[model samples]
Target: MNIAILMMQKNENELLKKWITYHSYLVGSSNLFIFDNGSTNNQVIEQLTNFENKEVNVLWDFNKKSDYEQRGSIFCDKIKSLDKEDFYDFYMVIDCDEFLGTVDEEGNICFDPLSLEYSLLNYQSNNELLMIDSQYYNSSISPFWFNKQPYRKCFFKKNTIAKLDQGFHHGQVTTSDKEIRTNLVHIHFHNKPYEIAKTHAKEKLTGRVSNFNLDYLKNYNGKGFHLVRFFLQTEEEYIQNQVTLNHIKSMSLYHKLKQLNLDWPFSSTINETREKLGLTDDDDSFEKVLPKFRGSIDYIAFEGEYLKIRGWGLVNYSRPIRYIFLQLTNRSRFRFEIIERVIREDVNEMLNVRGGALGFSARLKRSDLEDLTDVTASTAIVTFLNSECAYFKFDMQKKHKEFNYFSPNNLAG
Candidate 1:
């Protein structure tokens, strides 16, 4: 059966080459189709010439057509315009980073998921769609890292044609028959290093740049992540220890695909993907900012239900602070949570933040605050965040103990 893949692109040159290389191995280089969304770098379009696909659609300013609710219809119309001779048994559109195939434990990409399915191998069926499962991938090069979340990419059918639903996040496919599930996995490159992400963030998605919230942008934490103990580690040291985290539920199917030897460019694509991790060679692309720890922060106030934190290091939101460095304790009990604040906001030019404080606040319920206090004394916490680049203070001692930070010689200590 013939297979074809479709994808949209904007300022996606950061990992564009590697993405194409991986896809080339999945479907032949010839079956890959791309729609250019006014790529300023022109990298996506430039690389397209390397392979011969059925069609290449370029609409430089197709913003209105790319609306969340209108994309399905726009893409369906384009698919119909393609030459009938080049018809495909299955078609699925995805982003540059999404791999609609499987990868092994050794960090290697394998064959298509369908070829390994036992039910499909014996079936002579049509009019059914496969809702491919996807796992989010974070590149060491990406800036903001969060807890992993799983999502689906597209819908594929055996015989009858179907169009992808409008929303990219939704896996629904519109057809005469309802959607049916299939055992397929796709990998999506959810995060890229901060430097590269910033380069494309403005134009990468709908309203990502044009509609950026200036008030919120200044306080944005777009830095790489690492534990505090590793803060002093050099950039080179971290590179040697980077890892590939997988969030998929099944690996049996992935491993079996590896030995099948269904023939495509596996080694070359895997190598290309691996080599692009740190992106260190390009000085301008990946900035290795030395982690600045050992800095002092202040516990500005213990407002009703919020613990206010401020200081020089926290003021500079340009740098990435991985986790929310916070700790609250009482006697032997303690509470600590990663500081991924829902409204990670900072002060805007209009003084939007309360008292124009240039930092973040960890809102605590009154009962939670009482956990750290007593009639005669209170508990204190000294923790570091930004993946451990900066520090914050949370002290509520009645007969307070000596604070090293408050000493005469330890202003920046």
Candidate 2:
């Protein structure tokens, strides 16, 4: 049974090497298809060159764009094209931080190729898209942090996959009643060790992910990539607390196995390995700061079921404001939604705000409101870090527009 593993990465040298080694063992080194995401690391480039000589098909980005959905979709199309030629019997696309394996009756996680093949083939999934459940681990505080809904990865049989959306978060199968679960689990080291995480986050948020998109912080595919505020807030905590690598991994391993009711029989070996590598929580690192909140709403528009707005904000002191509250009133009825922050340097400059990139623009869907007809009025508000808030209300029915304390040419006072 032939299998092909697909992957895309940029500058995650250590994790990328581990992923390649494990997957190469699962499927032969020759069958791995790696797409280098414009990585600048000399180690990564050198390794890719070595693999290329070893019959691994190393690919470069087809689309120059950094958007994951677009790039991932293009990769899936390439996979489908390869499937047409009957080159491989199965395909799996995964991230560098993710490791694929199966659990045995003795509760041992097996990374052996034969074990993975058996798991995939023997597992019963009525749907063509086989869903591999995930075990997500946190970087700092709670090691075995359990998500209420852990995401599932895809393992496609020959001709089973249609295409992947939003970087493999969901699969659009050609013919399938619904996605079915499989026993295969990919332990996702999503929370990178602090040092690596800093680079990864910048590459993702500022580079590939495009923080300028309106849906930047909105929840997409239950993954909450859109929850930009959550990401930022958590990052702030990590920096403030100075989270460490060893602590995260150690705690996660201990608690995750505990949650699975499995025993960690390799404790001595693990410790020895760590010691040999000189790994320590004290040495792990991360560094980044979220922009403060305190600006003005310079633009607002209503289109169909969506309420579009643009503004700039920045906090002077204390804890930064991470979210803005939008309140709507209709004949004693009230509805509101929390808006996460986004990059907006142009407006921030126009408003003469000291905080760079204080501008936020979003297209929010309001299913909560029956109609904009009777909405009567709305308020755009931002509370300061000290619990004091600045707000402005406008008549929604009469089409009143209220620019905050500042306008395009005028700075906020």
Candidate 3:
């Protein structure tokens, strides 16, 4: 199948090589098409020219402004022209920051786009448009250490009508009467460094007119990006750093609506128009929910029936407390034990005991803690604690009822 991978990029010189390598690995070297929107760097130009010789098409549109809406329209026109000329059978429109791939039924990597497309096409969907989710990452640091969510809408099919709508971020398809197949994957770039994230947020929040009510912009004020960036940072840093929670809370709904833009109002109106949709009052408290273990504590512990003890102190005097606490009047049992203290290079010798076990250690700063939440191990612990805590609480109530019904003294009598 003849396929075209289209992308628009700016100031991505360092990332071009990796992008080329990854796409080449997925769909060979010749199928890629890149639209450079006024790159000032000569090195990036040289790199693109070099890749052009290897069957990659590089079009430098220095005349075009870097506004996402205009660029998207231009891109759509280009795709239409290519389609008219019969240049490609299927076109894949992706961003410079996105990675497209698939996980098979067995969760194996299917890097080949054609194969991935075929698999998606054959896969039956209840809905028409197939929307693949985006996985965001920090390319400058560790790529694997990232977050995956349904960030973007990437469509696929062998048809002339398919086109990407205008806008720099989250641009939807403008045409109607088309079925959407939500099956492809578009890994977006969401959590970059602070400055870059702020710039992006400002552009997205202020530049584009909110498809939602214009009033939505009044509360946004470009602070949601800061909160999201803080969220992506380590949890410890988030806690320690004096972020204005009230500011975040006040702007959250507006910020989210701004981020979602026209899509939000469009969906809400559709729902409201079709039926009597009840609007729930907002009860989200961003500040009050922040994690409390910001400073050094005796030990870090997550407990349940199966206790895991870690930390230098666990091997010593305390012998790590392992007990199931029953709510005084409830039959349910709460089980817990101390987990190991995490050791790091930044920790001091006085805190490190048991050959660096029982040492004064800094708990993960809020930023680090946020980062840890993304880790599978950390998430697993959190999940277990949540489930076990709920179960134990329920069990205690049942036990209390049983004890009250058949007291030990009554049984003895």
Off by over 4 Å in 2: 105-107, 123-127, 138-149, 207-236, 239-413
In order of listing, the candidates' clash counts read: 11, 13, 50
Top-lDDT candidate index: 2
TM-score of every prediction relative to native: 0.45, 0.52, 0.47
Off by over 4 Å in 1: 52-69, 80-86, 103-109, 112-126, 141-148, 158-163, 171-177, 205-211, 214-413
lDDT per residue (tens digit) for residues 44-84 in model 3: 88888899899888877543444444666676677777777
In terms of TM-score, the best-performing candidate is 2
lDDT of each: 0.42, 0.55, 0.42
Model 3: weakest 10-residue lDDT segment is 374-383
- Give a tens-digit lDDT track for model 2, residues 1-413: 88888887777766665567667777888888888877888999898888888888898654243445465686678788888898787788887777667644322345667887787666434556777644434333333321211365776777777778756768877778577666566667654444346556555666445453446545433333432443445444543443322121223344444444444323343345345445454334323222323355566655556555655554421112345555544423332243556656575444332222344565555454445342354454433233333343322322224522112232222
Supply candidate 2's per-residue lDDT for 272: 53
Model 3 Cα RMSD, 1 decimal? 19.7
The TM-score that candidate 3 achieves is 0.47
- Of the two candidates 1 and 3, the one with more favorable TM-score, higher being better, is 3
